[model samples]
Target: MVHSDEYKAKRLERKKRFMQQAKKNNVFKARRRNNFSKRPNFHNHQQENQQEQQFQKQDSTALRQRGFFQVLPTDDLPQVPQCSHGPCLLFEKKNGPEVEETFFACAIYRNQAEFCDFKLTFNKETGEIEVKEAVEGEEDAEKKKKKKKIFGYNRIPKALTEMSPTDTVLYCKTCINVFPNKHECVCEPVEREALERPTHLLPPVNEQHGESQFFFSTETLDVITKAVEKSKVDGILCIGAPRIFENIRALHPEKNVFLLDYDKRFAKFFPSKQYAQYSMLVDHFFDKIAEPKLMEFFDKSKSILMITDPPFGVFMEPLLKSIEKMKKRFVSTGKEETLFYSMIVLPIYIRKYVLHGNFWMSDYRVTYEGHKLYQHSEKTIVRLFTDLPVECIDLKNVAGYKFCEVCDRYVTERNVHCDRCQACTSVEQGKWNHCEKCDKCVKPRYVHCAQCARCHLYGRCIQKHDE
Candidate 1:
């Protein structure tokens, strides 16, 4: 008994010494710094105040020198309510040393009224102003008010429904033809050789390897474009959607766009230098194949943007892990202020990995380009989780979601919009669980049972039916 106790004591001592040594290592210190550095900085108040003062001074000087006080003589400036100093301004005036003849532009008149009819031109040599009225046709006015129609399953013409199956092809939400059809759609044929292995390695679809294709609608791409443009993102990393990559490249040709996917076929679409083949299923996938290339891209610039539509079932873990790896590689110590934006499209129910409070959820449902009516009862209520501020997006045009006045963005908890149910379920309860099959949210611990045709609590199904 004495000998056994001594052995155990020695073992414990050795383990303790090993841990002590590990703690002393530089790698361990780096890991600790990475984890704890994300905490809110409480000591920067003085520095922040100085920066704000300097910024205000610079902004006031710039606004004043831009000839904001010089009004066109021919045009009439609309009268508006005046403040104690002058006219009510759209932008707040600085309280520092005031410039001569500088007055604030009327907030309502400058913004609310139509400005397209008036054009202002300056002559450099003569220092003269030219004000011309723009002559626009009724057709031009109609076009300006019309919202660009987004192409989706909902937008398919009713006449297409009457067409014979022989003459029309059934396209999935991703715009892939899974059913029998004779009509030739615009979808490109799958490059069998380009797939790293097969479709089985991709996601939820465990079937035989074939054409596993999905494309983004034009309207969806437009929203993405606006977000990227507003954010001023210079480097983009796209995961699954090739159509997104193509559109992003066209929109911002100067920006560095990299594509990482299991589809080797993307090599043909983009130069070999721009594409990298990666399987998300493999552990440490980014470190093994993506790290070097990512470092090279990230080193070129600090502003990096990532957009991904991860596969169903196991989306959050691998996707978040990949994001952490990217952050570690790109964001070094003292570079926490580096602008990083991520736009993730995943089902609303998967909220386990969302414990980190850095992301904001969009209230709208994402309708994929080729989503078919038979496969999905309604458009899937996928959330657009992002770190960017809500002000970067125009909430009205984004669809199905609204900006919260309190949070300033569509948050995951307490702000969910159900399109099919036509309700905003934002009560005092925790986040709602959306069931795609039922086309609405079910109470916590409850699931939609196909047999009973309604959501029921787990392990308490009263209606006995075959699975």
Candidate 2:
């Protein structure tokens, strides 16, 4: 037993030695494996390093291309696409040192014996027009001087001035009606009263009242001008003779203009049917205005360029049907007389619910000719007709112009009235130069309107503003 026990102890010691040697070898192999894996020459290690570097570079680039680094409060961001300035904020606000003259021109048909509705709203007892003292801002002081000349007011209207609080008889020109205040009488009733007057008592002729129609700001004018200039059409087809037509006419006088409305009085205003020919026809009615008259006048086949602000509800369907009929006529007549542009300023619901048709997009063509030689010719139209990245239509033929492989396409040049240049619009945005009213940077490349006190760069800048 003693001999056996000694042999077993010797064997056990050998076994322990073997296990220690094995453990040491295993540690050495593990170290070698780790070093080999981390070596830069290996594909896995090099790939991992390259991937990490690429991810880091990508992350840095993403951070660099952000707008408004700090998260603005929810309220600060403009919810609706309007003058970022909140409600009534733009209407009745005092101008600062940076803002120039707020000498805004407002037109009133004096014959209507109605008090100023807006004036009456503030002071319930008095319908008197408030006259405010002019501020000492550089822009305002100059504007105040202009106002004195045009409005004949010694000072700007900041508080009630024209009439006394107790005086109930407001002496407007022709249509006289006693009202608690100007705001008491609705706009429709006031307009009706003015219409009743054979002739307005205060006669402000076209020449004298040139600045009366200057209610549209220079910024609004810029947007309208851009929309008109960018528009690819032979001319504009104005449907309703609503108050908006006056503004449209003032905005785009260069294009061939046609107007159709049920109101004979509105059409009668354009004597000799000169600048804009108005068709006084009333047959079919849908909304408040005539629809068939507009559709019939829309027959000048080369695709009518329509832009109007129609009333909502009833007028929507008739207008859409008229548009659809017009579109069908173009499609069925074996001529692709596509509606070049239909820029309706009214609500989209009125367009869809009332018009009752899909607004299909037609291809637009944009092109440029030699500036000097083709200076007084109709602007070339480039047709973007493809669904891919960039597709457009080429204005190869209109009425009689035939395309020749050798000399390209040529047409007899019309008078200089139709000559147009391809123009682009850029809205302004910058630090320290934001419009106080709109709170947006005015587009660059536009000349600032000293009179209107905003930026404007279009021929239509000097159009009529009188309602």
Candidate 3:
């Protein structure tokens, strides 16, 4: 008898579930077995055998020495057993005549666990041992320069000079540079209430948010101001950072600045007309753009400029999806541009993200006022990724900008000035090839595959081999 299609489908589903469960159980069992194999057994036969041999050797040595030596007795002398191992210099003071008066110790320098070869000199008079690290010579600096040349740009360039302070513009304490004012100094004295406000006004400290809500420095705010003024940005959409929205609004009150955040507390800071709460994690908010409430918040006619500091640990997918939803509402027709500026606040960990043709990185190290979660008194270094080109701003003693030959201007980080191609390309670490056919430089190791009639990644196209 043949089974019905529905019945067979249900049967297949049950079989698939059972197979998955079986596979999971097998993996668990394998892991358990591997863990058990790694554990050291206390009653190991080999260790016990070694101990037995040691005892036997001691007994035989005692027997051989018994007939050759005579025992001596002294009533005043303290009993001391001979050391089985060779005389250890670490305990030498205890064996000497001045044993009662002197102390002895031996420690691995700089907390090194293995192969400690450095000799530490001990002063008997002062009861101290001094250890100094070997000095780095001029050769070390030359080696560093050589390493920098491999990347085609200096990590620390000589061209960046210190800026002089001016009374006309307010200089950031962290960045130590006057705010650039082509028209007028947009910098205003922050109110005492705003400065003294609770840190909770920012995003909450949580794993999902990466606990990374830090206030931008005065200089960084100025940089934002310059970008806004230069691009003639009319509408601002701030995600996750309400403070940034406030700053932009204060600078350009005429511009339409809106704040979109997951937290409801941000609404108190901004007007009812400007602030809208939207959770990125919620599929209804991020995925649904046609919703009346969301549509009302985003206007289609205006050119929107979005600025955000997304959670570093969270994948870019959710953030991108949220941006897509916003763009659907705010993006205008014709030659109007929608600018996106994102901040990735992390230490020197290299993260390779998918970068589109529109994306351009900033060279300036954005200084951030640390929160309770980060608890750093000093401002943190943040990398800004933007679609708009920002004028190169350098922090004192920090190499933040690089000269781009193609753009005829100084571009930001992760951008290379390719001498061979005679253009500035976004190729990371200055790695690229000058494609003769394309008459341009291409990133990511692409080779000319004649059979494919285009350039493909090295060894990727099968048609090239077939040709």
**Residues 197-293 of candidate 1: C-alpha lDDT, one tens digit per residue:** 2222233332222123545556566777777888887888877656677677766789988777655534423443355655542222222344566
Question: Residue 37 CA error for candidate 2 (Å)?
Answer: 74
Question: In candidate 2, what are the lDDT values of residues 1-467, reduced to their tens digit?
Answer: 45688899999999999999986764454344344364333346666567546645664323223221111112232331111111111112122212221211111211112321111112213423235445568456455534521111111111224545563333233322223245443312233233322123233222222112112223333434454455545456555423334455555555555554433333323322312222211113322233333343444435555544332212333345455554564455454644545544433222224332324211221221222221222332211111111111223333322332332322222201111211111111211233445444444444556565556544224331210
Best by TM-score: 1
Root-mean-square deviation (CA) per prediction: 26.2, 27.4, 30.1
Runs of candidate 2 exceeding 4 Å displacement: 1-221, 241-244, 247-252, 271-301, 328-335, 348-467
lDDT of 3 at 212: 37
Question: What clash count does candidate 3 reach?
Answer: 1
Cα TM-score of candidate 1: 0.44
State which candidate has the highest lDDT: 1
Q: Tell me which of candidates 2 and 3 scores higher on TM-score.
A: 3
Weakest 10 consecutive residues of candidate 2 by summed lDDT: 81-90
Candidate 1: C-alpha RMSD to true structure equals 26.2
Query: Please, what are the lDDT tens digits per residue for candidate 3 over residues 75-120?
Result: 2223211111111122222221223222112121111223223333
